[model samples]
Target: EKMPLTPNGKLDRKALPAPEGALQTGTEYAAPCTVTEAKLVQLWQEVLGLERVGIHDNFFEIGGHSLRAMTLVSRVNKEMSVSLPLRNVFFYPTVEEMAQAISELERLEYAVIPQAEARDYYPVSS
Candidate 1:
């Protein structure tokens, strides 16, 4: 007897397709490094109508196209205040990875301020 191979001509059953551990059993998601990733996943689920979306899920595999990606980016910009370069999203497709990258970007590019309505300069009284 011979073993079976997948349609792609690779070892099928021997490959072990699913995750080894209980990665997604809980109600709460693992906290993402940046707000952008958390919101991105939420938006993606709403746009795609998915029951539950894992951070590692592939966008293209879930029927995402360039136009949808553009819409997603627009939402991200409006909501997260992060102007993601179009290419960067494709490069870092996963939520966790993208979050780490965005967190790095925030640390490097965006200056953190304690107050939202902080004046640009101290008020001058004459």
Candidate 2:
């Protein structure tokens, strides 16, 4: 595809069309359903500087870089109260995948917690 260029020979970013198969702006969008997805969508919007972000939108395709990804991971840890490895962001670039990874991390954390052991109780005479 040919990129639109300005009179000065610079790429006209504004005139460039959205990539094929990408969600177009101003179209009806489906909001996130679960809390995790909602949080991710909000974070993506803030981090990526876009007005609307769908669950299936690709993070990198929307101008996300390594620094932004790191920032996103940090925010996710702070907001979601979970420790997620940085690599997970690359592995799960989309909100849906990231949310699923967060859910799995939460499940693993819950599973790792040690249960309290039962203790015998003795009555004391006054």
Candidate 3:
């Protein structure tokens, strides 16, 4: 049975308190194996300075803001070649969801995108 209850008879997640101390490093999540999970965890650490971050932890719950969220997406693109839009993070905040998105993105970009259209173009310097 659920341990907590909200005002409206829902899960009182906000009312629930955090652990007494900082989260422990190497905490495990039921996340799948994928580059996206690794990358997302790394970004979380760089932003939060945590030795390790679990997959199920919420970014904002851990003190992330919109500015930091944007930074995260930008870093994901630059580092993982995955152009994760800002909204995507909100929708898929968990590592498992993000990994699914990353796999789908890889399939679309690599398997379906036409080579000609995907080629990087540079305008002539005048």
Q: Judged by lDDT, which candidate is best?
A: 2
TM-score of each: 0.53, 0.63, 0.58
**Regarding TM-score, does 1 or 2 come out ahead?**
2
Greater lDDT among 2 and 3 belongs to 2
lDDT of 1 by residue, 57-92 (tens): 666566577887787766666567676777766987
Q: By summed lDDT, which 10 consecutive residues of candidate 2 come out lowest?
A: 106-115
Error of 2 at 123 (Å): 57
Off by over 4 Å in 3: 1-20, 23-32, 107-126
List model 3 lDDT by residue over 23-102, tens digit each.
54344554435666887788777976766567777776666788888888777776777667799889887666776777
CA lDDT scores, all candidates in order: 0.66, 0.83, 0.71
What TM-score quantifies how close candidate 3 is to the native fold?
Answer: 0.58
Number of the top TM-score candidate: 2
Write model 2 residue lDDT over 30-74, tens digit each, in one string. 688899999999999999898889887778877799999999988
